[model samples]
Target: MPVPNRPVRGVAAGVPFLAVPPTRRLDQPAPVVVAWHPMDPPRTEAAFAAALPLDGLEAWRIYLGLPLCGSRSPAGGDEELMRLGYEDAVMNLQGPIAVQGAEEFPAALGALRGQLDLGDGPLALVGGSMGSAVVLLVLTEADRADDIAAAVLVSPMAQLRPAVDATGRRYGMTYPWGPASLAVARRLDFVARVDEIVRHGQPAVRLIVGARDDPDGFLAPGQRLVAGLADRYDDPARADLVVVADMAHALAEEPGVEPAPQTAPAAAVDRHAVHWLRRHLGGTAAPGLGAAGEEP
Candidate 1:
């Protein structure tokens, strides 16, 4: 499938963009961020929307380009570095900036949550690819979502991006603190630190990654995320690998092609993810946490 120069934009049949864009809770408000990265959306988004019912919360999606593979060829290979926290600032690019990396994604979005006046409502994040790592960093390590009720991620990675220059490419993004954080994390292994936070932050998530979706660089990192989530989730198999028969790196042959709420394993898993999130963020038919396995 050939990726467009721009990220594809289409409102799911009924889902519409909010005009006021309330980032936080106002009156019995429910807010959720459905985040996705470039060369990747179909694998995660549609199902996530299907799984969750939009009875109450204002659901929104984050579309970005995450650096996962050196190729960036739109061939579905995700590797490279500095995708450290998927899309506060950096995502996939078509030309010169394609390989460039950035930090402060989770933090940036956290601030955006505030800037959007999304501050202090019920917040939840559903991210795919490197965006998954960003969710963890903001939720557990950076702790942007302390006020948030829950977060859900499908296919997250751990520290897959490479080391950036102390200054980094983004002007003043690191200036003093960013570099320091990355440096310290590099030595002590931030992955371990985040794992501890997830244990206690207690955000219930339904994480899924493909077994055959190995991009070499992305594999080990994605696995680490699986292991960490497995530690937190009791039924690791059900919570982690939603494996379909002989799948490849990309979920299917095309993007934006699948129907919502279907019987196929891919469709079911996707629907489950959406359903679980709507439940997480609170909907008319919302179920509480620890009830991820209840049928959609």
Candidate 2:
């Protein structure tokens, strides 16, 4: 059955909220939406701290709400992507950390550091598109390098500058940016930083992509990152890639590899990620809210 398109209701304040069933069983994962609706004001480290229940928190899984700039896919696809039902609780942020003009990348790291805590159990990172970029950025932090247990990156980009270049090439032209863009680019190199962390922390990393995704850019760079990981660890399977046959960017199938049922590709991606996470975290499911989107 097709996942029904549910109407998103916004607060009187205009922030989009994740609508979930009110009553949940103890055995089932609790759903929380940390959505950054387009209209909400920017957030700060203190704001992030206020939103999270980090006060002597026990076991919890943290799901960063990193939304792709242009993709409409709902964050993490509800029950489908979280098939293991391992999360007993979830922390959903409204969106990526707030940054001023040209401050997006670095400030984003600061926001992540303020909100992320390994807690008392295994922590897993999941990101799609730009959100994945944020995940990679957080892992690169020297102090936080060994904290994450595993990561799932979907349609990921390896660096801010190249991603911008890729966007220009795919869309047929480049736009102008101030010095800030260059600064962000120099500081955030996803592939290299991830490789550095993986060499020392050895966190299990999984890269999921659409075979023909952003054909001129996204796919090739992701493949290169995987190859680089193999070279760094000398184990091809340590950081592997899974290309869903008919999936497109953000797990949508508009530009599919082949004509598949509407749900097959996403289901396949979910299965692989959940299974790998299970193995990496020693088969113990962590707690988390089910989904997220760019906290705006």
Candidate 3:
């Protein structure tokens, strides 16, 4: 079955989302896979949905807009975001986004489930870059942490301090890593909180990174996260890392606030994500699935 020409779009509990229904099992309640877009390219919910639709996966693929992003951007838009980043990247931008995104998700999720008539069973999660930090926060701190069945993180910000450092280097500005920012970094460091992530359900986790992404910011922390999870998981294979060749940090072009064509790297990441969700969510992949240009 082909995906709808336009996905079901709505705002639930103050969170905007794009929902792609399963090709199979329309009448029955389907498992949900909620995803958060990165602060980088393919940043908005619609853009992220276009980038990684998880084509042919038999589940509800819900792309959620992060707080202060997409339709929820402040009055000054990207300019405001940049201003916040300059003011205090951690306290003003990253910290609030991560904390608010995680805090607001449960209500949004409940509203979505009620509105869509989705299954009450554990759902899967997917996130990219800074959005991946939101996923980690949910896994570690959300009351519904135990309700997550699986997760896939792409070019993830597993550790916030390195990402902040990388940003500082990119713009040739030294970040003032004060006590407040350092505390925020410590809270957002997923690799340091692996035990909390698996304390309840031990959800299957797969971290996918681009081979060309910054090793210090993304690759190294992802590797460390997998290693830490491996030590805790009953089956070490439940925690895995995949490095995609010829790929980089961002999945789409600059000014990624709108939906755009999916890139090859994004497609590759989607393939891995779909396969993982299928295995863990008890769904089968459709024939010829996981190909670029295919719809959800």
Q: What is the C-alpha local distance difference test score of each model?
A: 0.43, 0.45, 0.87
Q: In angstroms, give how far residue 40 of model 2 lies from its true place.
A: 18
Q: Candidate 1 — what's its lDDT?
A: 0.43
Query: Per-residue lDDT for 1-296 in model 3, tens only?
Result: 33453479999999999998877644445678999999999989999998998987878899999999989999999889999889998999899999998999999999988777776645999999878988999999998698899999998889999988877877898899999999999999988999999796899999999998889888999999999999999989889999999998999888787788888898899888888888887755555665433323
Best-matching candidate per lDDT:
3
Which runs of model 1 end up more than 4 angstroms from their true locations? 1-27, 38-58, 62-120, 159-191, 215-241, 252-266, 283-293
Can you give the lDDT of residue 282 in candidate 2? 48
The TM-score that candidate 3 achieves is 0.93
Expressed as tens digits, the lDDT of each residue in 236-296 for candidate 2 is 5668788878766644333322223425555666556656665665443335522221110
The TM-score ranking, best first, is: 3, 2, 1
- The 10-residue segment of model 2 with minimum total lDDT is 37-46
CA lDDT, candidate 1, residue 263? 31
Q: What is the lDDT of candidate 2?
A: 0.45
The alpha-carbon deviation from the true structure for residue 77 of candidate 2, after best TM-score superposition, in angstroms, is: 23
Candidate 1 differs from the real structure by a C-alpha RMSD in angstroms, to one decimal, of 11.4
RMSD of 3: 3.4
lDDT score at residue 125, model 1, on the 0-100 scale: 59
Error of 1 at 111 (Å): 7.2
Clashes of each: 21, 8, 0
